[model samples]
Target: MTTSPALDGPLTTALVGTRRFFTRSQVSDDKRSIHTEGGRSGDAFYRDRWSHDKVVRSTHGVNCTGSCSWKVYVKDGIITWEAQQTDYPSTGADRPEYEPRGCPRGAAFSWYTYSPTRVRYPYVRGVLLEMFREAKAALGGDPVLAWASIVQDPDKARRYKSARGKGGLVRSSWDEVVEIIAAAHVYTVKRWGPDRIAGFSPIPAMSPVSYASGARFLELVGAPMLSFYDWYADLPNASPQMFGDQTDVPESGDWWDAGYLIMWGSNVPMTRTPDAHWMTEARYRGQKVVAVSPDYAENVKFADEWVAAAPGTDGALAMAMGHVILKEFFVDSQVDFFTQYNQQYTDLPFLVALEDAGDVADTAEGADGPAYRPGKYLVAGDLDIAQAASENAMWKPAVLDARTGDVAIPNGSIGFRYGDEGWGKWNLDLEDIDPVLTLHGLDAGGTASETARVVMPRFDAYDGKVAHVMRGVPVRRIGGRLVTTVLDLMLAQYGVARPGMPGTWPADYEDPSTPATPAWQEEITNVPAEQVVRLAREWAQNAIDTGGRGMILMGAGTNHWFHSDQIYRAMLVLTTITGC
Candidate 1:
């Protein structure tokens, strides 16, 4: 076919066939050869040129809240097709293998590069732009004077505010945008503290360089940076309760290694498309999975069991499971494997000294009532302990010694390491040390007159089965008072009632009214009581069979709670108990 006449070139209708033109059919000016020496179709060559002219390595850095390297095929500097890059250097054999990561949000991003809605230049309200230009002229081209005139006058600022959301944004030059922005910042800072001029964007995980640029500038200007993770409530703040950590979870490849897997509110198939293959393959390898969530979550499709727990009741179910494991495995059988695990890794045996809160009816004017999270801890101040600091010796934890009357600091406890060398390490070893016994004891007589009970942090399913409030725990205590273990307090807070303990002291686990028993959990969670108890045992047994190979992959649905820390603590309880 003859090449079409060019619209912009110096060609007119009059010269359509008058000259021997340089068209696709004829390239020579002499017109001796109308076609190329080879008569083969020329469309293939041009198609190849347009399809694969050049390719540059780049990535889809758009809506994913992140980016991944992609091989972008380009023709004449225009992007055509892109695919996941495979050349990233693998780190190690153990870590999860990653693909050039992307989400469905990326598919539309290439189109958005040149979309009509793309913000190609700085923008301001049309009225504001005109007003600013008028101000500049009126102020004799002095930008600072123009800015002050526009912003200082209430009418000038109000005019733009009234036009907002009215689709009147005008393209603004970079200089004008920067000038106005700087003036606004100056005005804000002069009137208010730098902290008031806070900047917020997504946290660095999605785009570190972009985030860092804003952060660095804010830091220089003494302006506060609002943490996006905290503001958006994405942080797993419960991580620190055990030993501060995140995202160090095993890779998808490691899923095949699991004997039992729990997907706790993590929508793996949807959110983790790259890792979904591993999950499917893991099922093929015969690894069992338990999906725990409220709304029949996406990952439940892969699970052997789907425990549809009620909303916000995961903690209650978890606590009930903990009760089963602790009661069946630890208390009933005293399984050496689990007992040793607790003795080493957990704060299970840490001591909590009991303080009696006089009946709530007898509340005095200034006296503080019952407190679950104690501020201070009980210490043997008279024992002249060498490890205890002279100023704040009470903060040291007192573990039971083999000696009848003496207490010692367990080798791995926060108390033993506090104000000492190598204090930061979270090693689980309790060698050459004794854990405080989990039995009730009474300090009958002491200079500090009030009788104190040695308290363990077991949950009392019954709110007040006995006259004493077993559910109440002191968060902190001052010197010359009682102390408690973190585990003991946490358990009590969860209401894991231990039967056959003392005079009706613990709740009857079979009773649904008891807060953390499977029956009670069933009421709140809507998960059957049998499922909770069975899953707890099955999970524990699986961990034991596989040498602590059970895992739970969780995400933001549970992390965004006001009581997220409690949820994390409950998970910590189950994982620590199962040695997972």
Candidate 2:
């Protein structure tokens, strides 16, 4: 037979021959090329893979919580740099403003990423080898390198079985490492209970899910809570006393609505940002700003007046100012309103008189004496009855001395006692009378009079004369003094004989013979005498003023001090007395 021309040489030879020689040759050639390419391509792929792996691996050591973006750098098939990705969020061609990508510590991300001290592999020593041998023998297996054994019998034995079980060192595979960690967590939870398993983190940056889980777990386990500020002493001490709750201050809204602002011991600008902003706004709005502090602060700069008084002496300053305000007629029109509506000012005179007469027990009487006990009111001596009263007449009985039944006699008593060698005996008989009548209750004209008055003929009077004390005097002090002197002069000059008016004085007066001793003054504050007196006078004037408001703004700088609570309380007193 004749073979086809197309297949004559190779096909005919292949049909006649036993083996397919041309097919074998083609296969061989293809195999050779593939083998050659595999070596080169494999190396290149592995190199790239290893470089990418290193970059990812380095990220494990970074203490970041995704709050910032980052960049990675690789060189010679290894990660070399990692840094805050300031250029991230780039708008392709158009660059946006560079925003900081990390916290202060994140700036050093590169240093940690490229640290030479980082361990790349599990290390094993002779002791580890011995432990591996022992484990293999115990498991009825031929002794093998620990790392290899872990990979071979992952399901049968722990990758770190030797180290974990017997506290022996052993090399482990990645899978084994993960398994070991999981098992440990499970074992701990099972063995020690959730209480002992507080949390697991090498850093403070916790994921939200993790934090929630941990927090819930801790609450369930009855774990002791970690406090935010362990260094605050006043919070610990005053919280329970003031709020009856374990917190420093209640979440009260802005106090800027006050017609008068009094800042006692608070420096708004240095410490508090929001309040400082409000104070600035208040000043811009022409709201009267009063600062009562020992230190001249940024708040003082905005103050209409500043009272640099002795620290801790604020209570005295406040009481004195109240006295002055009552004596003067400045706020006389509002006295009844305050007595009936505001618990703080309602029975202040009576309370002070009680204190003066030693009528207040060690426990002291409430604002509405004979009704509530001391400490029942939020303020020291303030009672709800005082606030709930319909008129000053309703609260007048509480102000009188119940023991001797002696009350203040209004116009019947002169300003000063005269011709009284044996006056003590006669006064004793008068003290025995009913206090309502003796002290002078509501009379024909619906006015109350001083039972027995002691007038100061040399009293300083400033009527219709607008005198501006330095901005350094506290508004409360100024208000108090102005309220007392101005009101008194106005009443005396205008002949308005109203009971709770400017001309009326508090029944209780400070004994000039018993001024604060030097030792007592030094114990309370570090202010000079002259400054203390001046501030006291100004605060007094402010307290009684009719056409003013008092406002107080506390800032962080003032609050962060060791004596912040005391300072704040003092300021509160100053403001309260000034009717701010």
Candidate 3:
């Protein structure tokens, strides 16, 4: 038979035409599909891309929070595919194991290694390099002087500076880029001093070599090494403010141990994909899950209750919950665990000096007495304690002793640890003194009903106005000065209307005018008063029942506000009071 002209020529003879080698596959009787057998050979070529010579264990080196172990399959010398390693260490016998901890981004992360958009080499800004070259020629090839010439000129500086963020970079050699950086550093050090040449880099955990090298170089040059947390605004200011540490938080696996979990402003399912299962698994163990978000977030589906607060108004909702906790568990009736924990672990028992606001025009008197503002903590130096007049005595705070009902200076204060080595007790060991948490029952100089109404900072009040609350504060006249415990001032700050007190404590949770009432918080947080009340009760109950297994998983989402410290501090009050 005569072949078609399309496949007859010598030019076409070399080409592999499927028509000559194979017949058309028959269609199915139903006419919905076709069957082909020999064409499967082509799939082998595609499958060969996945055939690897070696498998290497590695991890993604970005600023990823999930530093998951990965098995990278390499063919010849190139990575072909990756798989999650299943050899993660067991958390505990009862807890869920941490295996296969990776996300989609991590799975496709290897593609970036060979992507066209990857920066495989150093690049210099086009305008900057042009200026550098011109300056180098004019300055007789002195790189430092050439860099100085460009930076010193206002017009030249503006030309390159304004070109930034417009993306006009050119390929550059590694040596040339290093030389340019050195020149810039030398010039900056000479002109503005080494203090001005601060260095900031990537997270050290991911890029330890680069981070350590840059840190060492900056340190040698007397330049301050800026922290990555403040640079990226992910400092979690509340941690340092509350705990005297920036990174003292519990690990993600700790979620399994939490009896009551609150996912506040953290989208665990979406962003933290690897750690999301800990929440679900914890729920299987009868753990209560609550989601605190403005919108219906991905994590809300997993929550038993969703507290939809107004955006950036979490501080208000938290303060309201704190009010409920302080009312029921602290002020109304003290839980034994809460009382013991607060007395031993927290600064609530530390005595504070009441500043005399004699000339202040805004000082208003409550129905019981004149309002006084809280001052610094009353230290050992302020009174004649056992350690009075000792070196660094000012740092040791005084507390009311439950055994003697006297102001006793504790030994584990900063004074004992810092200046004097003779004062060896640097731990929270109470030794013999039983520090009293609240002065409600224990009489001071006056009757148990007698209390101080104090003025403290209330950031979420009327148009950012300060709030004044009245509470029963048992005071002591020591060394011709009046002092009250931090617990009493904190109660006043939270607007917890104690028994037998007067002034602006909310009539009830329904009272809308008070600062921290659930109903008052409704106007700010848009969360229902009933929800806040219920959640607060449940949270406190959970903590009491489980011995402080209540946990809140907070992240950068909530810690990025203007007054993030205050916002976190507000929620932290709930856990602190509940001893969670």
Candidate 4:
């Protein structure tokens, strides 16, 4: 509020021809430099310029799972800048905090929002717009007739379709576009069916209001709503096949809990940028990381081991690992947890009929022989096992209860999922039924059938060497039907060389003679047999030590292949065997 006597003078020009004036506040002891007074004036300009009227929490529209919150600073009703919100709840004391959740894309969203090429309104193809305008003028402004006139002409339709993706889009009015869309939907319903009028508003998770609005309109019009989730080329078909869900992955937060992680074709740092930190943090906390890729991908930098596999041979590598896991964990040493998990959760205990459905091949008279080919699961209906009132007995699979040595009908088979369906019997309630995994020694009042050597069609390394691998399984007579446990067939199918188990089993991990062995996979995958063997052993051991804390993160690189389902199934089967 008051000035010193030294400042009682006109503001002296410190710098020539500039408004900046400064008084020598202090002289350095060296006398080479001097501290100035009026230098603080420029700080006020920056403080005013950076000042904002208000701040609001917002999210970027970049279609990521993070959904991070940002503090958008607004000045004069315009967004000035954004900052990542730091008030996220603590994950835990052990895990690294999830503050600063934004990425470069989220930070630069305001620039993209105001970019010149960004579409601010509805647009129509220029060629289509021309045809529509002409039709509209000729049809007396009836949008339906105008649209029909243009589409009904094959030349006009083809011309507009051909013009698409060539950057001829012109600005469109919301009213006109909405009218044209509604008219097109009406025309499509009338010409074809309501199913032809499909809607494709995407990413319901990020834009639920917009997605639901389009979905509601489509539903009202009886039009099909195309899914954005699981219909893409890279969609993981194996997830639904194995777990009955489109994506059966754990939450991103669970990455920290894994003791061993295999990045199978997933470039997490590039694809899942927001959650990539969790992987590094987990690694920091001594979790082992393995990267399986043909190229040195971005994720490989974070891995403790890198397996350079040949392209499209992921299934071979997976099956090789599965072979190793089955041999070491299940056969060589029967892990208690793995055995219990297989017995309780898997279909290994289910029985398979030796004969095709409704067809039983004749064998030598009274020789305890018959059925050549394996059919569907031998259900409860085939054994005259009574079900609860109003239950579908045919859908319930019959399992041999090891405790009672009696054929038991389980309560949670797919058949129990249907009939008398308010809630349906979907729970995994064994209800005192301890199913036998293998019927290798079971006898049902009659002589046991001789071992069945089933020939499985095998394709050798995608190299046109097609052959059949014979697997010998134990079969028995159950209720006058030749049958075998699924475990017996699977062991033989997986080429597990267990002692006393007859099959086309590999001699060892180094055996190239048998298929799905590590040495066999080396020819296809170009990955070292020793690496696969070591990874398998380590993965299973880690799962055993950590109570199944092993995880595999896979992505489009594997899922984009033609045989992606088989590849995923091989990987999943490896986990199933290791109980990971």
Top candidate on TM-score is 3
Ranking by lDDT: 3, 4, 1, 2
Question: TM-score of each candidate?
Answer: 0.70, 0.33, 0.84, 0.80
Global fold similarity of model 4 (TM-score)? 0.80
Candidate 4 segments exceeding 4 Å error: 1-49, 135-157, 163-165, 234-237, 357-374, 388-390, 414-431, 441-449, 453-470, 497-515
| TM-score winner, 1 or 3 | 3
- Candidate with better lDDT, 3 vs 4: 3
Ranking by TM-score: 3, 4, 1, 2
Model 1: lDDT of residue 302:
78
> Candidate 3, which ten residues in sequence have the lowest lDDT sum?
12-21
Q: Which stretches of candidate 3 lie over 4 Å from their true place?
A: 1-46, 91-93, 123-180, 232-234, 246-248, 357-372, 389-392, 418-424, 444-453, 461-473, 499-503, 512-514
| Better by TM-score, candidate 4 or 3 | 3
lDDT of 2 by residue, 334-406 (tens): 4433332223222233222111212222232111222111111111113344322322222222223335432
Q: In terms of lDDT, which candidate is strongest?
A: 3
lDDT for each candidate structure:
0.63, 0.39, 0.80, 0.76
> Tell me, what's the RMSD of every candidate?
9.7, 23.9, 6.0, 7.0
Candidate 2: which stretches are off by over 4 Å? 1-231, 235-259, 293-296, 304-334, 343-548, 555-567, 577-579
Weakest 10 consecutive residues, lDDT, candidate 1?
A: 446-455
Question: Alpha-carbon error at 121 in model 2, in Å?
Answer: 22
